[model samples]
Target: MSHARRSVLVPSVMAFGFAFLYVPILAMIGYSFNNSRLVTVWDSANSPTLKWYSALWRNQQVLDAAWLSFRIALLNATGAAILGTLAGLVLARFGRFRGRTLFTALTTAPLVMPEVITGLSLLLLFVAMEQTIGWPAGRGVTTLTIAHITFSLSYVAVIVQSRLAGFDLSLEEAAMDLGARPVTVFLRITLPLIAPAIVSGWLLAFTLSWDDLVISQFVAGPGSSTLPMVIFSKVRLGVTPDINALATLMVLTVAVGVVIATVLLRRQERRRERDLRLAAGAD
Candidate 1:
């Protein structure tokens, strides 16, 4: 193809792809303001009102599910970050250790495993545990959180491992040469360098836990529904304006978070560049 035609064709295809992906989301957001009882039909006379948005605020079930999902996600993210970081460190730092291949495989197994199989395996494990030890007598938030962490930890580990792969080991060696203990060197040097990766992993884990449905459904008990579970149930009953409103609010929240994080990161990058330039000038 000619360069001119290729350029135009590429941009047209890109625009079409983006429109195909985002048009539905934009329509959902627009319909959230519909004032009519029937969500699918948008009547101009009664639509585009804030009635559903207001009604969503008073929805006790949705509120409870949101709160529960947030709490579980927070805990799952923290636990997954800690455990995954340790596992990643072991793989990255300790070379040729016994059972290293097995450990690596086990750590990453969930990344490729189907969600249905993972959920079913977890359900069976929980049932066996309850029968044998009488601990965790029933499936609930704790079990759900644990299940989320299991899968999320693998994602975190992958991120941490990638971050560690490009890390400069000389910094840690220098700290150790100065008589700093391994723990102190890690806390002072290694952790600081890998902080961004850890934070990214935490966010990834949180998103996974927050959006999980199939695994959560298998593990959750009565009255322990997550936001996704509630949304799924509502969707089955047919589209509702309140659900659309709720989804729009969630999209807005995530967009705002992305904007804030982008601004903060850009500021940090500019500051780092300025510091580097100042140091170079001084040298």
Candidate 2:
């Protein structure tokens, strides 16, 4: 009887936990279809409608904010992936060198740093740079993208470094043995092997940048508001069905991206398995 009770208790607790986490999200999604303009209220008199989704397209401010956010995210992810890959390669492949400890510390610092502190520090740095060099002109998309890239590179670097930790160095050594230069070996062998990690890092960075509000709020100026900022401003006024619809659309987009990434990773795994089998047979 005690064993049965324990089992039931565990399942009951798990169900409760799941409901606690997902019930609000589910409710939010449901309310996106609500005919009521107010997000929180569901009226029995009115039927569910798709007007909010249509209104989303007509909302020029939201559209412009989303576009700017996408552009910044795209650029930030690309830049972070490149810089992080290089930093990861240095950490993973190069032996101890001058300032290695400092480099490692700086690369990983942002992972643990508070977002508010990072944002404030970056804002100060940008202000100082503008005063000194008279460049950047003012806070805007450029500064926002740079700030996102700065914080995001640490995450990408960690991912790439972990991917490289288990990587076989013998392949690179063999390429070099065959008279391939270091650059050639990296471009041909190392880069291809680590391509998946780079892609993953890029996606992670993009998501971080897209979802960032604190950092963007600090760095952004007039005419450079992001989707998160827009949503936040609307939320402050009072939640609207349009915002709910926007959030639901974002959730759908992220879900679809996850599904596609999963499929691609599975295909890559299958291809890798086939290649391993062919290599074994040849041996």
Candidate 3:
């Protein structure tokens, strides 16, 4: 093909692929405005209503479930971010001695393991622990958070490792050579440089924790139902209009956050490029 034709073909194909992928999401969003609770049917030819959105506010069960999900996600993501970043730093940078590979393997094993298996294993472990230690008392938010942390850590670790792999370490070396203490060098140079990766990892972990249903279902108990678990139950009863409204809201929030993040990242890249160009011109 001619170069012009190839360029057009590539962009056309990409546009088609993206539209195909997003059409369902767009349709779901549209359906959330349907006046009919039956869904899957047109609300009216002329209008869409925000009644479902208003109704969502009144849904105490959903509100509580969402609050619970948020709490768990924050706890799991924060804990996973710190713990996994430490592990990732060690494994990717300072790792030494035998069993290092084994530890690494175990850390990432959950990424490939079936969720059902992980859920079952964790449930069994929790049960065994309660029986043996009598400390946990019962499965609840704490147990669910623990389970989320276990699964989310792998994602956080891998993200941090990727960031560290390409990082320029001379900054830290220079800081240390300038008489700065080890902790000072780490705080000033290393942490700031890796902050983006850490934030990205935390967001990813939070997303995974929030989206999880199978694991949460196994570990969650009374008054500990997560948003996804509630969604799961609603889906089983057939997708209600209210559920569609909730899903639509979630989709919008996620889409907006992703778009904003992408824009910020691109803007940062452009700023860096401009700075480099200016520096080069000055030299």
Candidate 4:
């Protein structure tokens, strides 16, 4: 193709791609401010009220489900971060220990495993454990959190491991050479360096847990309906302005989080560069 034609085609395709991906979200946000009861109709005569937003605040069921999902996501993210960081450390630094292959496979298996299979397997595992040990009593928030953590940890592990792959081991070795204990070196040196990846992993795990539906369906008890579960049920009945408002709020939240993470990561990167430059100058 000619350069002019190629340029036109590229811009057209890019615009189309953006529109395809974001038009629905933009539509949803627009409908959240709709004054009409019908979700799609624009009541331009008395349009753009905060009526749905107010109603969403008063919605007890949605509030409860949101709170439950938030708590579970928080727990899942923290647990996954800790466990995954440890696993990543082992995998990246342990240097081909016994059972290393098996360990690596098991740690990463969930990434490729189907949600249905994972959910079913976890359900069975919970049932068997409960039957044998008489623990957990019944599935609810606890079960949901556990199931989310089980899968989410793998994602964190992968992120942390990837971060460690190109890590500067000289700093760690220097710390160790200076008579610092391994634990101290890790706490003071390694952890700070890899903080960005850990934060990213935590955010990813939280998102996964918050957005999960199929797995939560299998492991959750009758009363432990999460935000996603509630949203799915409500959607089947009909699209309402309140749901749209809720979605808009969630979108705003995710947008803010992405911005914050980006800012923090950039600052960390800048600081790292400055330190390296200072060290180089001194040397």
Candidate 5:
């Protein structure tokens, strides 16, 4: 196919896919206002009501779980971003050190490990720790965050390391030649270049922590519930229109975040391009 035709075809196909994916979500949101308990019906006469949302406001269980989820997500994501970026920098730049390959391999192993296995293993470890040390009385938010950080660190490390590999180290060398200290050069030059990678890693870690079910289920104890766990239990019991309401809110939140991130990335790319053009002109 011609390039023009391919472009059109690709967008058309993508548009169809997006529509297919999101239309159901839109319908779910519409159904949240549904006065009837049934999800399938769209009866306009008795259809529209904000009762579910109102009820959701008063739901202490859900509100508490969501608060805990957000807090854990932030902690896990931030911790993973810091530790992972440092590790990634060491691996990518330091190079060929003893046990480097072994550590790298071990770090990435979690990516392929089954969720059930990871969850079960963590659960067992927690149990053993409590038995031996008599601490962490039971699995809870702290334990859950630790599990999420374990996996998130691997993701963040891989992302930042990949970014560093393609980055221009000449900037650092140039700063040093101009009489800047190594630390000063790194703080002013290297950090900004890798900021995008760090942000992306943090976002991924946050989403993973928030959406995790299996590991949270295994590690969470009495009263320490995440949103996904609550939703899973609800689904297993039976379907409720309330679930659709909850799903609708989650979809909106995620969509807004993704859109904002994409816009910021595009803006950054444009700024970089403009700066490059200006530098070339100056020379």
Candidate 6:
């Protein structure tokens, strides 16, 4: 293709892609403010009202589900980050330990495994554990959190492993050479270098947990519904404006989080670069 034609084609395609992706989200946000009972039908005379937002606020069921999902997501993210970091550290740094291949495969099996299979297996395991040891009593928030953590940790491990693959080991070596213990070197030098990856992994795990439905459905018992579950049920009944408001609020929260994470990562990158320049100048 000619350069002029290619440029126009590229921009046109890009615009189309962006619109295709975001137009629905824009529509949802717009519909959240709609005054009509039917979400799609715009009531222009009484449009742009906060009625749905107010109704969503007063919805005890949604509030309970959101709180439950938030708590589970938070726990899942923290647990997944810690476990995944350890697993990644072992894979990246252990260097040909006994059963390394098996360990690595088992750790990453979830990435390729079907969610249905994973959920079913977890359900069976939980049932067996409960029957055998009389522990957990029954499925609830605890089971839901554990299930989320199990699947989410694999994602975090993959992210941490990828980050470590391109990382410099010289810093840790220098710390060790300076009489720092292995633990100290890891805590002081290795952790800081990998902090960005850990944060990214945590956020990804949180999102996964928050949005999970299939696994949560398998593991959750009575009165343990998550926000996704609630939304799914409500959508089956009909798409209401309250649901739209809820979704818009979720989108806003995610957007704000992404912005904050981007700013923090950029600042950290700048600080690291500045430090490197200063060290080079001193040397």
Better of 4 and 6 by lDDT: 4
lDDT winner:
4
Candidate 1 local Cα displacement, residue 18, angstroms:
1.9
lDDT of 1 by residue, 1-283 (tens): 4787669888999999999999999999999988777877888997779988889789999999999999999999999999989988887777798899999999999999999999999999999999999967898889999999999999988888888888768878889999999999989987876777788789889989999999999999988999999999989989888899999998888778768876876687578669879997999
Arranged by TM-score with the best first, the candidates are: 6, 4, 2, 1, 3, 5
lDDT against the true structure, each candidate: 0.89, 0.92, 0.87, 0.92, 0.87, 0.91
Q: What TM value does model 4 have?
A: 0.94
Tens-place lDDT per residue, model 2, 114-148, is 98999999999999999999878899988998999
Superposed Cα deviation of residue 31, candidate 4 (Å):
0.6
Highest TM-score: which candidate? 6
Q: Of the pair 1 and 5, which is ahead by TM-score?
A: 1
Deviation in angstroms for 126 in model 6?
0.2
Count backbone overlaps in model 6: 0
Clashes of each: 0, 0, 0, 0, 0, 0
lDDT of 5 at 172: 82
Q: Which stretches of candidate 4 lie over 4 Å from their true place?
A: 1-11
The pairs that clash in candidate 2 are none
Poorly placed runs, candidate 5 (over 4 Å): 1-16, 177-182
- For residues 1-283, write the lDDT of model 4, one tens digit per residue: 4687669889999999999999999999999999999887899988789999999989999999999999999999999999999998888878888899999999999998999999999999999999999877899988999999989999998898899887868989999999999999999999987788899999999999999999999999889999999999999998988999999999989989989998989998998989889999998
Model 1 spans with C-alpha error above 4 angstroms: 1-5, 273-283
